[model samples]
Target chain A: MRRHILTYLLFAVVTFVTWSQDTTAVSTGRHITPVRPSTNVVKQPGRDVSPELIEQYISGDTLAAERKAREDSIRRSYPRYPMMTSLWLGVNFIDPILMAMGQDYASVDVHATLNMWNRVQPTVEVGMGWGKTTPEGMNFTYRAKPSPYVKLGANYNFLFKSTPDHQAFVGLRAGFSTFKYDVDAHYSNSYWQEQTDFTLRGEGSHAWWGEVVAGLKVKIARQWSLGWTARWHHLFSCKDSEHSQAWYIPGYGPRGRALAFTVSAYYTLPLSLDRWPRKDSNYSAIR
Target chain B: MPLAWFYGSGTTKQVTVGNVTVYAIGAPGDTVLVNNQSVNELSLPLRVSTDRTQWCLTFMTTDSLFVTDTLTLAYRPIEYFASVECGAMYVFDLQQVTSTHNVIDSVLVTQPHVTNVEQVNLRIYVPTAQQ
Candidate 1:
């Protein structure tokens, strides 16, 4: 089906270019283009031969295919994405929504990425998070005020050669945060013959972690886009607290948990729009 | 967990605390966990309410010296989920340990995190009679 479509496309382009003087609409089926009276027609000697046959063609689009082939050819010869492309500022919605829904822990983060050649994106994220709750069926009340965290990473887009309307990327990030919280605990020590109740205030802790991310982003408007990323994070190291371990590390989520997720919307800022290779370039389109 | 006591000055042979009464400092109305018993090893309950625990070891020496020594432990009380049936509990992560060098010379926290595993969490060192 595709081959037939391409054949029709080639036919239409040939006919259109050859008969610019004719004012007839191009149709799908094979129809001889009418002679404009200025062109010469020759007949073959064979009995069953077509006399000056004019072919016609039609299809969805070979424009993209031809452009891709040309781009691929040029990429094979010249450098790909040789210039700085754009910068994207992203806002996360999943965490904020979950936080509003009374989740135990959540964050609001904004990130920025430098889209280099639509191939690699180096990014940085900064956010403030809070965790305030006593888990159901637990006796202690844990509280942490809004704490700040930062993450630095880069993403490699799998569809680098394709249009920049969407991306499928896998990336890595190094995250860090330092914060303080208070845990109010009330536990009965039967052996000690007492009911203990007190609060440990100003408990400080710092943590470092790494995340492996895989996500997809699609442009919705000219400058607006939405994306979702699933992240697998591991606590690399945390400053051990003698009173208690960190229940939550702002951006990284729960202390011992490994999996996390986020949905984000991006506002793109074009640093420099990439112009495709022009006809004057070394790998210009062939006639 | 039971913290094993040892004679720390040099002898490899383990020693026992003769006629020692052990009680938490914050216990109400003279409540004694160990009442004048020969103690080689004992399990001490840490308070979940606070980060510091102090225990008074009243040693009845052979010469009738009723010497008193203090054992202080500083730790982080971590909330732990033991099991569904047992519910949540507290575990101690030992941070700092010290003892007045009267009869008790020093304190050694062997395995810091106090959990359900029945291992030595601390080694309370005392001078030998030969010293």
Candidate 2:
């Protein structure tokens, strides 16, 4: 697994480097200012207005009107904000570094994602996921209980810029994962050992997690886009609670720490009230 | 049907030790028979069954085994087995017995695709008198 991951990273770096060499400037930097035309101060006979002055005045008025029209056209061409919702079929695998601590479980993660981005493209997302675990497989210790987890998180897109048809994003996420489960205590005492008793109970705990991601969204058809995201994640959970001392929830394992590498693919659809509009040439002539 | 079950699948075929008949069904591939006549065998990689409808067992004999075939054994409601894994057979040591739960010895056995694995929840029938 480690070798496979390293190979993929190397391949990605090579591809990114190769793609960056193109100087097409599909990128934006600081705002570019519009150049102003030179003004002519000349007077005309009878009307007290010079032809040059009238032409200049008309041009100035036209330019101001065109600027306003352009702004309005851009607004009409693209929605001020886009609401997006996505669903993904994901496979998640958790490998245990500490064999004595717990075993690992891999499952198909079903997720529903909701995102809203403002004009500057500030995006926020929340996902709901559910998966299954191996009951008595590997190094798992059963407290004879069911464990469930809920994940809540927020992401900030530092830079978001792309054509109306496609979107590219780089973002960072901070979130919390909470689980409820139970763990059985092993005893050496004969009375306890002889009974082989295991208690079924509920436990609750949370972990603070962060991830950095870069992704691309490509429009496939009307109202639909396919997106792929690669993320590196780090999570830290309390190993033992000060109030209730326990290694960790049964299914989740000891809280000490855990890390996961994940990649996701999603199908997204626009949920905004207004859709992308075509640019109008008339708006340019007005100015 | 009277259902008889074993823990997992693919254990070495157990042979009779002297006149003592060790006719038992625990793992898949365990051969069973009546006297020297072969009866039935099972499929590989057993899975847990919650519904009594899914539990099945067949038998085969060693000698007089003119025909070899498999048949589903009846489920003995008096007996219950869960569809949960118990690791390999070797590593598990009988821990204890509770009012509702029982701990038995586990053994680590290798299968075709898997490495050393443990069997979980091997059933042990404690007589009423013993209990």
Candidate 3:
């Protein structure tokens, strides 16, 4: 009976061991999910940029770039000084005519000019001039008086951002006058000197004159400015004659005179912009 | 821009332009014409004058295109007479011409029933003797 029982136990043990080994083999045999060599991590959306970057775009960097571009362009252009369309007023020298015969008197001129370097300026000037005819002992009257002249011209300046002081300039004048000749001038009740004095009876003739001028221009202040000008003029053809015999005229004998001269000065003024207008590069008002 | 030479005062003389001399001869206040063209029709003032030694005259143009007349008379004591005998005489004097606002090179003279006369030479008229 004992031997039969031992055999039963052994059989049971063997059956159990076989079953366990079968389960282990099944477990190692198959894998349902396939293995991949790389990780599958996802990237998150950007949400943490620094505030300074945003502020720089809004405040200065873009503006600075635009400014730099403009500066470079200006540096590449040619420099130019534009004409100033202004009225000028300043002091000047004048040469006067003393003879009706057109000879004998070449007068010294001293006067002031106004509206010198400003736009739409009005000016008035007074001057003392003296001229002489040859052969001084004749019985003709000769002298220069304080004469006033009106002049109109154009003034300009250059304001190339690339240059210094914005060069200033003015030019080409058209002038009108009541300039006249003194036929017979007497001094201190003395008989007029022949070379200095003369005989002609007529009122001064109205004349039209023209000139070309150039000058340096500068701004003294934000609202004030200054200029130094040089000008040349032609005292065109005028008509006159020697009156009576022994008129005692010298240099010209008995011919009409033509006078021409130059004027130079420094223009100064108080600063005021009450009526001045802001204008474009070409002097036209900006719309 | 042109360079202009202007003679201000002197005796008026007839001058030619492009080689042509024109003249109109008549008593004072007589209407004259060149090629049947009336001179007064253009309305430029003509003037006459006399100096101690010669006669001076000039013609003026209106509007810078015409001429001015400044005539100088010879200072002959005989010319001072109120009336004179009838005759024609010619006298010449040194003449200088000028312009105010235009180029003056030639002169034009209009005669009664005659074609317009033009001259380039400077000439002045003075009778040898007053009648």
- By lDDT, who's the top model here? 1
lDDT of 3 by residue, A5-25 (tens): 999999999999999999998
- Runs in model 1 with CA error above 4 Å? A1-79, A277-287, B1-42, B46-118, B122-131
What is the C-alpha lDDT profile of model 1 across B1-131, one tens digit per residue? 33656565565556887899888897767579889988888788887667898888888766888888888888887765442223346777889888887788766777988876678877777876777
Model 1 is docked with a DockQ of 0.13
Q: Name the 10 consecutive residues with the lowest summed lDDT in model 2 chain A.
A: A186-195
In TM-score terms, candidate 3 sits at: 0.33
Fnat scores for every prediction = 0.23, 0.05, 0.00
| Docking level of model 3 | incorrect
Chain A TM-score, each candidate: 0.69, 0.42, 0.38
Which model, 1 or 3, shows the larger lDDT?
Answer: 1
The residue ranges of model 2 lying beyond 4 angstroms of the native Cα positions read A1-103, A106-161, A184-203, A219-226, A232-267, A271-275, A279-287, B1-131
A35 Cα displacement, candidate 2 (Å): 29
User: What are the TM-scores, per candidate, against the unseen true structure?
Assistant: 0.58, 0.34, 0.33
lDDT string for model 1 (A95-188, tens) is: 8788778878889899999888888999999999888877677667888878999999999988776556688999999999999888787767
Q: Residue A120 CA error for candidate 2 (Å)? A: 6.0
Residue A88 accuracy (lDDT) in model 2: 25
Using DockQ as the measure, which candidate wins? 1
